[model samples]
Target chain A: MSAVAKTLDVKGLNCPLPIVKTAQAIKELAAGDLLEILATDPGAVPDFNAWTKSTGNELVEQSEEAGVYRFVVKKKG
Target chain B: MDDSQGTLSLVLFSGTDDKLSSASILTAGAAALGRKVNLFLQYWALENFQKDRIAKDHGVSKDAEPEGASLMRLMREQGSTQHWADTFRQAKEIGDVHLYACALSMEMFGITKDDLDPLIDGVWGVASFMLEADGPVVFI
Candidate 1:
């Protein structure tokens, strides 16, 4: 039983947009709900890591395949 | 890891797009991480923001003069490049970030609140900004 409420595909959007969209999406979810983000930006790896740390969001699971990166983030207040 | 130092304070003085873009990247990166970000714009940086031309100018630094044209062309081709100011504004929606104008610079240049982008949170003297913002400050 996963807490994930939805998935957001922000592939092809680079840098700030990806993060920007993710931030926007997370807002609609309740605390403890999860969001799955799919992105193609190679920088997403480090960027996601840093974002999770700063925002107090929980990066529950993450994986990379080829150029695409997948992330599961739990909303935290 | 100085994660405890979770605030980013930037004193942006350059008017060029390259420098602004760098600041935006830092702001977004920091903001996304849940750190607070404060940007104090002054001199040329504040001068560049003409509301009508808010997102149109891409004046590059003298150092990047040689490659400026090609880089801009590439950016145009990518179509993914966004104005740094807009990036900063968007970052605010997700995290704790603020944009401020330098009071002395505003007076020196005859800039009014009306002249600045709406994204600017407020105007304050350098002393005031320095007092309120602390952790890590970057001067551009």
Candidate 2:
């Protein structure tokens, strides 16, 4: 697995904030770097998938545990 | 990411907090996906963007009723909900989001560019707004 370049904690935020914050965080990363995001919003599951897809990034991994959703997304090269 | 998704234009006529919040979320989401967002504020919506009043309470839409109002209040107290203006500011910071005040509404409300909050890019006429609105506009 590729190393995570940054970890973004977006817990307690709802709706578009997680996606918005993720987009902002990803912008600071070099192309091909991985961003690990931890979010409490249930909507993050689908939001992350769509966000990565539309932005041309890759969803490297995604999982949920005890209501928290985690996503590792690789920036498009 | 490329701005290949095109522009999403919003015509905001309502100044209610709930409606504005919803609009801000839509703007932020579109912005996150590399879309250019253009917001044209008119009528009551323009009034809420005044420099001195932007942070003040604009209340909920009448349809929200007392119950919906309390629910929103509860969410706000929990810090789960952010002010719509702040969200718009963040959207602008992170992406291509432009906010414009309707010139006709500005004339009706006796508001000038100086009276508006700094978040507004500028005052625009209806024709100017339509020119940038390449896609179907969402009215709120």
Clashing pairs in 2: none
Model 1 lDDT vs. the true structure? 0.83
Question: Each candidate's chain B TM-score?
Answer: 0.90, 0.97
Candidate 2 is graded, for docking, as high
Q: Write the per-residue lDDT of candidate 2 for residues A1-77, one digit (tens) a residue.
A: 97999999999999888998998899899999999999999998988888888889999999989988999999998
Best by TM-score: 2
Cα RMSD for candidates in order: 2.5, 1.0
Report lDDT (Cα) of residue A27, candidate 1.
Answer: 87
Which 10-residue window in model 1 chain B sums to the lowest lDDT? Answer: B1-10
The residue-by-residue lDDT of candidate 1 on A14-61, one tens digit each, is: 787788889889989998999999999888888888878767888999
Worst 10 residues of 2 chain B by lDDT: B65-74
Q: What is the C-alpha lDDT profile of model 1 across B15-127, one tens digit per residue?
A: 88889888888888777666778889999888877576567766789988878957965785786767787788888887888889999999999989998878888998888
Model 1 / residue A56 / CA error / Å? 3.0
